[model samples]
Target: MYSAFKIGKKFLHYYFTAANGKGHGVHSPFVFDLITKVLNDTTNHPAYTEVEEQRRLLLQNETVLTVEDFGAGSTKGLTKQRVVKQIAATSLKPKKYAQLLFRLVNYFQPKQILELGTSLGITTAYLAKANTNAVVTTMEGSAAIAAVAQEQFDALQLKNVNADTGNFDETLPELISKPESAFDFVFIDGNHRKEPTLRYFEQLLAKAINDTVFVFDDIHWSAEMEEAWEELKQHPQVTLTIDLFFIGLVFLRKEQKEREHFVIRF
Candidate 1:
């Protein structure tokens, strides 16, 4: 993980260089629509408050659990024991980006959704709520964390989610081989290292359709992650790429004969 000062510097550079959130001079009709309809949508969604309320409650909880570090460890340093508040603080996606994900699902209405990480299920709830008809399969590495996420799902009454537990390496291949593995939308947030990140992307590629969209979290987290992001962009199947600083979105739309990449401010 990069130091706070380094992350701050990168953010400053990104902020100044990326295109504004507004459609402005962006010429691609599809991207323009995304900027106007999804990225810039201003409606105050109810899920914002609902999921945020769960985040608020978790922030105050002092319950501790034994954890297993499977991926790139936490920024605060890894430990076997951790408090719920500490996990929530370190792991949960910020409400802003989580709500953006909600809006994306709400807009695209992907029938089959796959989320590689379900840290406390805050983001999972947002995804499941966006399209009630969609089936969300969310995976978590730790059993204790997965249990807490299930509790959150029950609290939200999100019946569409199917939580899977275990290391992604052991769990993902089986999930991908299933008959219904043709995922319409995938959110990759589990392991942050380059090899695991690329491995998951390549494995998931087998089930990807032209319309399938893949979102990678912490694209600029480190040098290796940035390398993975660049290699993904250069792949022949990736027709379009969107860089939102913290997260990167990949598109494999067949209609786009020419590839394009955009760094958009969010």
Candidate 2:
């Protein structure tokens, strides 16, 4: 992964060059609507309050667990033993971006959602609450952390979440072979390396439909991740893509007509 200084410099360049978040000067009607509606929507839905409260509880919990390294390891260090609070602070996505995910699920209402990573179920909770009807299948690498996440999900009564524990490289293929093979929305957040990321994308691609939405996390975290993002953008099946600095959203919608890519400010 890139150092803080390097990441900061990249963010500065993106902030200056990305299109305005207010949908200004963007020509694509679908993208313009996403910018004005889902990306910029400020409505304080009740689900935000619920998930945030769970985040606060996680931040305060100090229970320690031995975590297994499955992908690009944490910047906080590769220590095996870590407290719940520490993982919550470093691993969980910020409320802003997380709320944006909730909005996306709420707006699109994808029937089947696949989450590549489930840290402590904070983001999973958001995805589950966004649409109770939608089933959220979340995968976690660490058994200890997965237990904590499952406990939180049970406590919050998020019945739609189906937590699976294992390394994604081993489990992802087996998952796609099941009856619930096709996914409407897939959030790739587990591994950050180029090879694993690309492998996951290819495996998931078999089950993806034209309307399927794929979101990749930490696209700019490292050189390899950025390379993976660029390759994904250039793929023939990818019709549209939006770069939000922190996360990258991909659209395979056939109705888009022409392939377009936008670096939009968020």
Candidate 3:
């Protein structure tokens, strides 16, 4: 993960170099539609308040759990025990981006969704609530954390989600190999290291279809993550790539004539 100063510098560079959030000069019809309809959409769904209220309760909770670090450890360093509120504060995605994910899934309406992380299930709630018809499979490493996330899902009545708790290396491959595991939408947030991130992408490629969309979180979190993002952009199967500073979206649309990459301000 990047330091505060480094992250600030990168944001400045991204803000200046990236395209405007509005669909102004974007020429690609698909990307233009995304910018206009999904990325920039401001409609506040009822789920937003409901999910955020759960987050508030989590922030005030003082329970501590034993955590297992399977990926690159946190920037602040990892420990055997961590507070629920601290994990909620640092690990969970903010409401802005989480809601944007909800809108993206709500608009695209992917039937099968896979999430690589389930930290407290806040983002999972957003994804599951977005499309009641879509089935969401979320993976988490720690049993204790996964329990908390499952409780959150139960409280929200998000029946569409299935939380799988284990090391991603052990759980992801098994899930992907299943006969019914054809994911049209995937969120890669479990591991932050370069090799693991790229490995997950490659594994997911076998399950992808022409219209599958994969979103990677914390793309610019570190130099290695940026390297991984660049390598993913060059992948032959990926038709289009969108960089939104904090997240990177990859599209595998067979209708595209040529591969293109866009950095859009969000």
Candidate 2 overall lDDT versus native:
0.91
Give TM-scores for every candidate, taking all chains together and pairing residue i with residue i: 0.97, 0.97, 0.97
Each candidate: what lDDT?
0.91, 0.91, 0.92
lDDT comparing candidate 1 with the true structure: 0.91
| Model 1 regions lying over 4 Å from their true place | 74-79
Candidate 1 lDDT over 1-266, as tens digits, reads 88889988999999999998897889999999999999999899888888898999999989999887688855422448889999999989988899889999999899999999998999999999999999999999888889999989998889999999988888999999898788889999998889999999999999988888899999999888999999999988899999998999999998997899999999
lDDT of 3 at 184: 92
Q: What are the per-residue Cα lDDT tens digits for candidate 2 across 91-137?
A: 99999999989999988899999999999999899889999999999
Model 3 TM-score on a 0 to 1 scale:
0.97
Collision pairs in model 2: none
Deviation in Å, model 3, residue 77 alpha carbon: 14
User: Looking at candidate 1, what is the lDDT of residue 256?
Assistant: 93
